[model samples]
Target: MGELNQIPLKTDVLIVGGGCTGVGIFRDLALHGVDCLLIDAKDFASQTSSASSKMLHGGIRYLESFDFALVKEALHEKNLWLKLAPNLCQELPFYLPVYWESKYPFLWMTKVALKTYDFLSGFQNSAHKILRAKETILKLPGIKKEGLKGAGVYYDAIVDDAKLTLECLYDSLLEPNANAFNYTKIDKVEAFGDSYKAELTNTLTGEKNSIIAKKVVFATGPFSDDLLMNLGFSWKNRLLPTKGSHLWIRKNSLDIPYPLVLQTFDGRIIFVIPQRDAILVGTTEIQAKGDFFDLKCSEEEIDYLLKNLQEFFPAAGVSRKDILSTFAGIRPLVKKEGGNAHNTSREHQVFRPGKNLYVIFGGKYTTFRVMGREISSEIVHGFGGTYNPGTTLQALRQPSVFPTFTPWELSEQAVLESLSHEKVRTFSDLIHRRMGLLSLSNWNHKKSFVDFFTGMLDDMSRYIIVNKAEITKFWP
Candidate 1:
């Protein structure tokens, strides 16, 4: 994992971003025997890719907009990944509670939408059912009882977004000619006779280098607009950057066996998902401004989410005190006129600014595989290589060192394995992305995080440079 100093000067393809879409394309091309190099400004999936709502469902709400085609494609990819990486993803039941004042007053409307959702998945998803108010309350304790008619129980997949992206990158690296570097940024690019030369800088060491590739691809997602303009690529802003935020609350804050879909008074849908020993609630669609990197949840957005939670679970007494941590991500929605961010389509768009440059933007996390194949097929064919789309359907070659959503003792061997194989560059990367420790509060539930990491600092340093100050910041 000497990615910083040992980067090649030339490759067949150079991918500019290491988000889910970029890593997905890297795997697809690597599987087809393409010499590829992928670079990211920070840890892979540290941005919008990891900041998803963490659900892999056909947008049931999208059906209202009649986006059947996008729903169908996403459903297929969602179901496929459920099979491809069973450990990283699982099918879960999502409960949509209905009230007397609900937009869909009757349960039949939800039933119709859910039936259509399953149909879009070719009936591959588990069947959905309508649960009576009593059953719904029993399933989700402490829920608001007034005006509750019934709930719609539907099946959707839940994914470990960051780990899934990292695993895809890991699988691509198994190919002999594929390589990737994190904390590496492409500073500038110059076209040279059907090829492009990129100036890359290692953000950590402040080292500079250059890479020449026959084709350059920008899978920059929400950062597409600023990145393209900064690089002087003559590209207009194509993204309607919508900021969505989530909160991780203590699991005891609200006891729900499964996820609850709450329809806010503003007609937006909020998901209260349970995962990794905490309750995950999110998502407000607002026009995003300022720097988009490493975004955090705004107080207004947090209050909005908590207000909805209070509305749904009036007796739960959930407040800011119950919130363990909060995260925000920008959605790179393809801009459309008139409608608000919530109504904008989730469809992806690809642009070829020049003969040798490809830019893809505005797609959901669940449909990344298909979005990536669209670019990979053309790039592989351009190189005179036979692109078999089925090649990427295979299982990932390397799994993460830590098991997702399972209880395990954090042993010395586990730390060594993560540092050695998971491309862990810093203590934050090890804790947040690779090890899946999202909330600081969860650290107290387990053993002393500080004590454990302090003991392993010497060994962790042998793999990658990390200091006690960095590890102390995460201490409870």
Candidate 2:
């Protein structure tokens, strides 16, 4: 909630990213009474964090790689979040459809996998079921009936990732010593005498400031390799940086009651999830070749998702025209020699490029809390502070004004509350992330639904700066 001009000149810890991981660390350290400042080059969760497939699950497929530890760790976190942030995350059933020609065609194999998945969660997850082929068809209308062999029903969770991250950051700000700014970029960092001086520039208003910290942590996800290289740090390219994209279509497009996991021709799994008014489909894994920031879904990736969707739901009649919008994000998977992006480990690695600097990358969103603890505990201990990993087990103290995955009537008071408390600095920040409106299609739908806010520009200007140009971008 602090303005860019009000950033403190010094802190005990300075975190250089505002994604889930960074915010998670901020909350953990702040809870332990550490003075911390977090900054982001853009709005919180505007990049990879917001562009996720919106699922928080123990990677069932990771079992193939014998990643039981990672899967178990992630499953525990997934279940914990369901209890900690029920308003922002929910448990959902996911169906793995198997065909006669499928790799794991036998129902027993899938049943065993589901049982193992449940056991990994210490049997905390929802009960698993083995649906007969007829039951699978009955549950999933319009599903491809050819060679159908049944489905394994298991439970995972779907989350409002951006809102959850924002809530975490907000919870951290409850500490008087904790502060954060979005649209603030760290231009340079100089280490001097057991401390680091970081120069930051406000991208929106072009304001400059400097902060001194005893320790600096970079929770920069996919941007790690480029940022480190540009900062003149002696860093190897540790990131595989795979791009995953998703598509949002009308919920009526596919009539499945639960999320369907489809195996692509190339042996990758794609999820078709129905979320309220929209059906979410996605995720193509390809090595990122260009700029990873603010990435868009490529035509080829879109085609790949569509092909898989059509293959799984031959009678669904899903097409390019059905896509309401698309989003893409780069996953910062740690590079493993001779390992493809899909097979790379989701385990995160922490590096100390200097005595006072730490960098973490290559973890899934589900395990962000544990990742935060891994680094924060070290940094907090280095500062001579007692770190209690259990402090973060409590529920988030700050919740988003507009909670996601639920419907509520928009109001002037809600907009004002978001602007005053949720760090709504820009028009795009308000619409695209905080409000969970991803694209123009969402705006159009909302506009037709009701006159949500009257004198909207005038109303917003009372809380934060707004102009006709920004308003026109949405309405025009």
Candidate 3:
């Protein structure tokens, strides 16, 4: 829906893909006063970035693998964002309940883990505590009580993934000579002198144009493998495309009092997080089978999540009927020689196929800002600009119009303003990401979702095309 009237003839830097990594570098170079243009094949952060588990935290399970450095860096970033964007995300205490039959049974194992986790954060987190069996049951009333020995309480942040990435782009656009576009794709790329010539296309309108860029970076995330190879770059498959899916269940289905961490029989972990009006559950890891660009939650993954969830909370009686909606995404783990997707390191790799071309992929969502530092620094220095690493440490300047959480009003004035400024080109962009309506539930108590938008649809037509069918289907 984002149709650009004028295309750039040339730029100092051209970034392909507008996910976290892409936007991270975009903001970095923009802050250093370099001319940069970022373009995405679709809406920014609409793919794997939006489909994450939605938690910004150090991987607690990675400790078993002795990935201390990654865990430490992620913990620092986790706590930093909790300070940076208070409106976009919130910190919550995660309860990891341990049973007698568990591989790492309570008190000692959880005690040592929580101590190390707190130490990694330098005690910036809400202090981790090891609770006894009685205390665990008292705090988590709906948890499985059979053979429960104790629990480990730690802290992490829950974020609005799409909104966070969008805010990053907005912050970069506030800088001088900074630009970005969505629904724009690079159909082909060719070498040209010190710079490269990129053939860009408008995916929606089929418009075509070519531009010369001094430097090109592909921060395509999971789609990196397929994209670079298709664009005729000197590329090889470096990604292990793994599918992970989630289900949003009605809140009352589980009545969870706190966010939880559950370990499964298959050596994977499931996160049960409770958001306003819904219980967010998910993530079945398997080899990705279909199109990487578009992924849907498979029945097997859905059943897998519900089954593991039921095992942890047998009294809740959760099933497919309780699901409000479902979403799935792929994880672009850099393929290792012998390890599987679950065991691959959460670190990233930057590839330089040509003197001016860089390809980056395979990093945790929490470490995006740091992941692009090397590329941004090298690119900025190439343009004779002093890249200040501290610039990104500051809080983002632009925030989404709608507060991502619930208990917020939806107004015509706000929606119209967002449409004009937030790069919202479609109806779904406004309703899903900007407005933060993940499910079909009505926000206003006095009106149905459709009734609330009854007259608004006509006004919305002035900016983007819309009809009652779009509003009608959301309600009934």
Candidate 4:
């Protein structure tokens, strides 16, 4: 599937993005014995899929809007993944500190909301509790105590987002009818007698090929609006793109003993999560401009997050100096009339421009497994196959060689297995996306990635085009 020249001449379904949604559908359909080919312009989960806030929890704030269904579905999926792939997910107690001057300022009000979250999950979530200012201060040592009421504690989860998506893909390919590629792109798709003749180009190599598919799906997310129009479909723009950014600060930079829900002065919530070796903080919502893919966290966003973060933990003295890295991506919320980005719902919408073409957009990362079921069911039924929703409830048939969340020795054998088995076609694909190493700093190796692999250049060349200079470009 990595080789573009061996592209299948025909497929039952052709997917144009390798994010969680695409891979989720691939697995669902493959379980029904359907033939599918998934292609991405970059590595799997390299876009918005990898750029999530790394949590798999029900949006507690959405409860205010009475979005109980979304919360329940997401919480169920969150708990399911924790059971299905325990290695990639960790459940943690999140602390939402309440301020007397803030909305939901009282502990009783916050406690009620937290209880609602637990109730929605059929009590699957751990029990909720309320801690007084003294108890809260004991857990989060440097918290600002002025007008502090209490903290509402509830359960949620964290995950290696990119690794989960990649494993979904690897599991799908365990079926003979499922195939996928990383750097190949479907450039132009057109109707050809009840089907689509998709023109695919190797974005890195400029190698061209065409394949006919009975159904062509667009899991392009924010790129859906522009992609459909470019492909000659009379597609109306249905997306409200909002840019959200996150920062990875050095662990122990602040007194955050547990993940936090920071209620901002502007009436928005900012999450402060502690992951391995770092604290993951995010997320600002504003209208996106310019490019939609691989966005950089803006200075305004950084200033906003840091200012609010400092307000909650005044004694911690957190600043830009503690920041290790930053990332951003557009949220492809399905547009509603007169609705702005902040108020828009995180629900996905599907558009059928032709008889068999489908365009899917929106929804959060937590509910990706359920997002593709509507289409997968239809596609499977067309093939006279039974689609079982329980099929995906099983554990993933394949797991990535290297494990995240825990530290392990980086070996030459693991590196080669990643290139061959993980569908890694580029050095960036291997290090940044597939291996879940955002940078050399994330690697556990004492020496540089280049120094660790210098002896295996000859063996590594069989899978990826790596040299001393190229290796340095990734690490340095």
Best by lDDT, which number? 1
Better of 1 and 3 by TM-score: 1
Candidate 1 residue runs with Cα over 4 Å from true position:
1-5, 445-447
- The C-alpha lDDT values of all candidates are 0.88, 0.87, 0.85, 0.86
- lDDT by residue (tens digit), candidate 1, 1-476: 32434889799999989999999899899889899999999999999998999988788889999999999998998999999999899899999999888888799999899999989999998999999899888888688899999899988988999999999998888888889999999999998777899999999899999988999999999898999999998988788999999999988899897988898888878998888688889888899878999999999998999999998888888999999889989999998877569789999999999887999988899999998999999999998889897998898878888878666687899889888787778788888998888553565544477778888889889977877787777664
Candidates 1 and 3 compared by lDDT, better number: 1
Model 4 TM-score (2 dp): 0.97
State the lDDT at 323 in candidate 1. Answer: 90
Error of 1 at 289 (Å): 1.2
Q: Over the stretch 283-342, how does candidate 4's per-residue lDDT look in tens digits?
A: 999887666877899899999999998899888888998887899988889999999987
Candidate 2 lDDT over 118-233, as tens digits, reads 99999999999999999998988789899998999999998888999999998888887788999899999888677888999998899999989899999999998899989889
Itemize residue pairs with steric clashes in candidate 4: none
Candidate 4 versus truth, CA RMSD in Å, comes to 1.7
Clash totals for all candidate models: 0, 0, 0, 0
TM-score of model 1 relative to the true fold? 0.97
